[model samples]
Target: MTSFAPDSIVLNRKLPLWYQVSQSLRASILGRSPQDSLRLPTEEQLAGHYGVSVLTMRQALKELEDEGLITRHRRRGTFIEPSAQRGAPVRLLGSVDAIVAQQSGMTTELLDYGTVAVPSGLAGHFPQHAEVATYHRLRSEEKTGEPTNHARNYVRPDLAERIDPADLIRWPMTKVLRDVVGASISRITDTVEARLADPETARLLQVPLLSPILHYTGVTYDEEGQALDVAVIHYRGDRFSFTVTLDAH
Candidate 1:
């Protein structure tokens, strides 16, 4: 049996439990050697390991099954798919550095730029703020020109004032925060969920209505712990595989 380190399987309560579990298991599945066929722990055991309920663990396993990473049989337990693709491209989570590297080579298109009153939906994320600078950007593959991501960025008015539109077209928002806004980003908290595309998002990404999308909400904080930026990004699930690397030690 391959045992995952405790740090490797730790879950963030802020994110959906099932999504975190699924991503952890996906990393393990894809990390397996081609000749290694391993049977995974029972739902109850996995639930215990991750400090989640069995029902939650079951939901996590179902996500893997949906992705064809594992097969579950009554009385026989769950087993990894021997033919699962290895070295698949996946979006690495839990690190800003990794994220910046992953975004390299992608083309960015600025869709909308304005300073507007914070919408009711985002009001809570930016408490005490009535207005913010908002930028809508669409990202695409440089070669294929296929749209991969759409991000709506709400920045603190002061920081937003320093951002150059041309800089956004050239680099990721985090880089802009550090270099242009001079905000010392000390931490970033991100939560991800699977959602169906709304009409506007569907049209923007050129996907069919109700297509499955990966919704990411991220908040970046400065050294003093004040929220500097809130980003709501939608990624085409079909175009990206999300992963979190686990330490074997």
Candidate 2:
């Protein structure tokens, strides 16, 4: 019996064999209780379940491990790792879990809110616009209350009207895009670079003027490739960092 969506390895034979097995295990791992989250099916049982050899199952486990989703114990079983916060030296490239992480609650300081032109050379990026709702937001780390990211977001007016003012201040932009604006995200693109924090940015971010900062500019697009929102984030270099893992494909 299949345990999760996209886990029907028997029916989806054309797909990569090991990957389906991993999704099935991923479902299992994520669903388990905290006490049982540490326990995993033996590699032999998992291999037999999908009619694959232990080597094939091991390969799938390696994929999960490299993603920071699991850890293996010598002479013991593998265990699930806890989730990490999304705000940071934000992942220019996102994983499935990282996308989910973006929706968690975080406090925000609303800087500016109003309508604005779509801007020159960006007409193709918007779904439709001469004017759209624009938001300037500053966020802090959830637990420590330290500054996290300073972001600006622009959404098409028709879609932007659905967003509640309160929700925009509290919810992550990713959630507002999906839940309030009802956009089906096709893909996201962003570039990370280093730059000096200007006076206003330094004051809002609580960093010294002219301090070096890590900056990111990102655009989210719909399935049709029309832009949903364009965002730029500035992260303090001292307080934030990204952990990048290299995976063998």
Candidate 3:
């Protein structure tokens, strides 16, 4: 059994004590200090270490059980379920348009289109102060019409100046970026995280709140390593997974 140390307090500004404790335990199980099957410490021990009541600790553990992160048995105790690892990256032509074109029945729905002042966070990533053209899109596959992805993309004002929002519905942004703006994508930086779908997103995607999903934030650069665009993509967890291969030298 793995025991929680004295400093294992879970921090949550908005949640109740039990939820906070649950989140803390969940993080620990997912990260370091993981305990294998039949190796979890008793609820009393966790309660003491986290300075929470035993009932609170039990509530926390219950949440984990509901999420399938842990399994609890009457006499055998609780155990962590090994998570499924992601797969190798699918190489799209370094272009979203190319990727979409390869998928036979995928369709894009232009959700909202307009120019907006660059957010400070987004501005920080860009080299200079420039109005950013923003596009929000929902992508669905096959005849099911079930949304598989939600994307929010940002482009430099000058590059996107002549872009018609309607054109985006017909042609993917990757083509627009390359053909219309004459920019070639040279590199991309991607960051992935496991997250629960928010309320609005859950409704849009026809999934329950707290449903697991993959969140991706990426920045694409031109041949000169100048940032061309930034995008955030959310993919359905059960329907999609990614793979990346590494070469050992």
Candidate 4:
């Protein structure tokens, strides 16, 4: 009656049996298997299925519950949290989708995508005024539809004017800029800081006023050493973290 392979290895030398079993279950859940949402089998069922003791199965499930993978209720069974549905992070340099992929059950929706005149302060960042264009987008995540980020991008007007908003829903903005607009991205300069979410941003991102938010500003350049776009993104602090590596040259 069990869906899992009976002969599956339940333990390894490098990890404890409980950890090994928890990892196996985590992988299954992240894979979006139908069993993910269902109440996991009881400890007795799991022990028999994995050919392990009931104590071992309980330890494994406990570890998973602590990691937010499974939720256990009294007189109820363990169920996978919706947040555990997202598989894993897909790295895309300086992109909104990359941020969303870090959390489970999160997706991006492109709202208000279009070209606009470059702002006065921002015009100084570009070489030519005529070359600059602007794109505004609101990114939200979760099946319940909650906003996670609000972003505005300024690109070369010549480049921005060529993109269709509909295409962005299928592909990330960077892909659209590269493949559709044929802009060869070469380098990126990015900076991140903590700031308070304004009222508008709070409402859009579904965060509280004065909530700490991570603000990222990046300038992307083309292969010809031309500035292609400047992107300003704000991410919810509660749900996001940034990591980078450095080398001694």
Tens digits of per-residue lDDT for model 2 on 115-185?
A: 98887646677745788678888888555676766888887787787877677676667777886677788
Per-prediction TM-score: 0.63, 0.62, 0.57, 0.60
Better lDDT candidate (2, 4): 2
1-249: candidate 3 lDDT, tens digit per residue: 455332365343344667657655664554333333335688998888778799988988997787666788898787666551111122223224324333323567999978888878888767685678889988775345667778888987777786777777766676677766688887678788889999867977778998998897878788888777788888778766665433232
Per-residue lDDT of candidate 1, residues 80-160 (tens digit): 776554223455555454455456546799998999999898887678789999999998865457787899999999888
Per-residue lDDT over 113-135 for candidate 4, one digit per residue giving the tens place of the 0 to 100 score = 55566776677777467445556
Residue-pair clashes per prediction, in order, are 0, 0, 6, 3
For model 4 the TM-score comes to 0.60
Q: Is candidate 1 or candidate 3 better by lDDT?
A: 1
Among all windows of 10 consecutive residues in model 1, the one with the lowest summed lDDT is: 1-10
Ranked by TM-score, top first: 1, 2, 4, 3
Please provide the root mean square deviation of candidate 3 (C-alpha atoms, Å): 16.6
List runs of model 4 lying over 4 Å from the truth. 1-82, 85-106, 247-249
lDDT values, one for every candidate: 0.76, 0.67, 0.67, 0.65
lDDT of 3 at 133: 81
Q: What is the lDDT of residue 82 in candidate 4?
A: 68
Candidate 4 has which clashing residue pairs, if any?
131-157, 132-157, 133-157
